[model samples]
Target: MNRFAGRVVAITGTGDGQGRVAARRFAAEGALVVGADLDAAAAALTEKLVRDDGREMLSVAGVDLTDEADVVRFVGAAADRHGRIDLLYNNAAAARLGDVTHTSEADFDFTFRGVARIPWLLTKHAVPHLRAGTDPAIVNTASVSGIVGAGMVGNAPLLAAYGAAKAAVIRLSQICAVELAASGIRVNCISPGLIDTPAVAGILGTGVDDRLRGWHEEQTLVGRIGTPDDVVSAAMFLLSSDASYITGHNLVVDGGWVASGGAGRPHRDVVEALEASLAAGLRY
Candidate 1:
């Protein structure tokens, strides 16, 4: 469990959800953690969680990852604090839901920058220090949305831009992996399915229809939605030496959603329609 002992990890979007959980996990595993988020209070809360567990962590609030200068400062601070950067987790994201027809330029831009550009900026700045560190790795957060847009349609029809942005991230990770491998730095990504994080709850909102949740759970082969911990565990593995030979890989941690086709009732409708046609004895 001390695989990350003495390592320095810099992660983004640590205010809540996946980022917060990642910070705590890395810190718990003996890494010196640095986390950044626009939500000052939430970032501070993540720091407190680490401190409460008797771990060392630095939380930077009001960090706009899209800003090159801000990202430079964040990465610079982490390297300066620990004298090297051992791992970088690009866990921050901005999601605006809308299909192409309804998606505005603003929404597409936000989603693209948050999911793709920000990680590139961070990696650009962190590469030098990571190149010098031990067992260095970068883990970016992608989504099943990037691989397939089928499952979330019923609940979030506006995820076209989000899915596209995530797909870009997967490509980015592969590029970085190949480019950095010679320097002993590994780059990879994790694609999570409908994880039940605080962010999800807030997005779904209180009193919102439960059908969305039901649909996701039913489609997943595990028979349930994923959790932040589920994702954090996969991320930790990718960052660990056990995966030393792995790079340029997109690990799907979706509880078999992608693997099993994630078929739900809507898909079954085709079968029902076919059966009804057969009963009419007019099938072509």
Candidate 2:
């Protein structure tokens, strides 16, 4: 509703998915948007989306958020272009799936850095400009994985490191909220449940698509999986004045999965046993 008119927003991971949606939505709200992503093509695509809407947006490709230098450059360019920074949306991250027992050192580190360190690095540099901007706020993307284990979300059992890294993000957002309060910058995070995003297209693809999709939909209390727009709406609220009193808070955009205590998920043993019973002679 144009709440962000004239506001400058710097978003990470704008190459696609939630980040791309964020860039376009923020720009649509009249916010001056700048974005970065490791995917040059995807980042350019986000820029084009905003442009196609007849809005201006600057996007930098191949930005390694784990690298302090790249983080600094991205933040600096946003400030230089907009003369201030009103929002920092730390929305980029990726992870490799492997059991904790099988997860290599490189994989763990890669996930940890991508999921957690990017926010820290971006905040480190953007805080200065944000200090001078109007209604400055930082919204980092966390996942329900941070609050729970991989088992709680889905059958993917290799997200130990990703969970650990996102846990750090949860704590980081809390820290920044307190640290940046004196400077008039609000810090918060959004923890999304399993959503329909490109990141998981492979996992939910192929022969297992229908099965896993059904499982996920059942696991959620709302009887459906989440969407990128589901998260974008929550994020928009947190960035808007409606949530001006909120800080150091994590908004979970799951469709009641967390609240349901993952009640919809039945243990494999139970399911198998029940099937055996049905096949044998146990019938209604």
Indicate the residue-level lDDT of 185 in model 1: 92
lDDT of each: 0.87, 0.87
lDDT over C-alpha atoms for residue 150 of model 1: 63
Report the C-alpha displacement of residue 44, candidate 1, in angstroms. Answer: 0.6
lDDT of 1 at 280: 96
Number of clashes recorded per candidate: 1, 0
Residue-level lDDT of model 2, residues 1-284, one tens digit each, is: 79789888888999989988999999999988899999998888888888999999988889898999999889989988878898888899978778889999999998988898899999999999998799999999999889887544455686789889999999999999999999999999999998888887765553656777777778877888788999988988999999999999999988888887776656688889899999999775
Model 1: which ten-residue window has the lowest total lDDT? 198-207
Q: lDDT value for candidate 2?
A: 0.87
The deviation in Å at residue 212 for candidate 1 is: 2.3
lDDT of 1 by residue, 1-284 (tens): 79888888899999999898899889988988889998898998888888898887987789899999999889888877888888999999987777789999998998888888999999999999998789899999999889887647254576789899999999999999999988999999999988888777744443687776776777877878888999999999999999999999999999888887877334577879988999999757
